[model samples]
Target: MIRILLADDQRLVRAGIRGILDDEDDLHVVAEAADGRAAVAACRELRPTWC
Candidate 1:
């Protein structure tokens, strides 16, 4: 499985991306962030395969 961390200032953008990725059985969205700092924090905490 591929873990993912999605970070975007726009909620819609994140949602759209998550929606697309969600269709894949092997792709998983483990965390989300609204800004850069939150993104970093989520990255550290979740340790997703892809940022």
Candidate 2:
């Protein structure tokens, strides 16, 4: 599986993206952050394939 970290300031935008990715068979969203700093932190913790 491909792990992902979604970082976006807009709640709706993150939700929309998550909704689309959720339908995928090989993609997985491991974390979501509202800012770059938080994203970086989550990245270190989750070790996602992308952020």
- lDDT score for residue 31 of model 2: 94
Write the residue-wise lDDT of candidate 1 on 1-51 in tens digits. Answer: 999999999999999999999999999999889999999999988899987
Q: List candidate 2 segments past 4 Å from native.
A: none
Most TM-score-accurate candidate: 2
In order, what lDDT does every prediction score? 0.95, 0.96
Can you list the residue pairs that collide in candidate 2?
Answer: none
**TM-score, structure 2 vs. true:** 0.97
Error of 1 at 37 (Å): 0.3
Per-prediction TM-score to the true structure, in the order listed = 0.95, 0.97
lDDT tens per residue, model 2, 1-51? 999999999999999999999999999999999999999999999999976
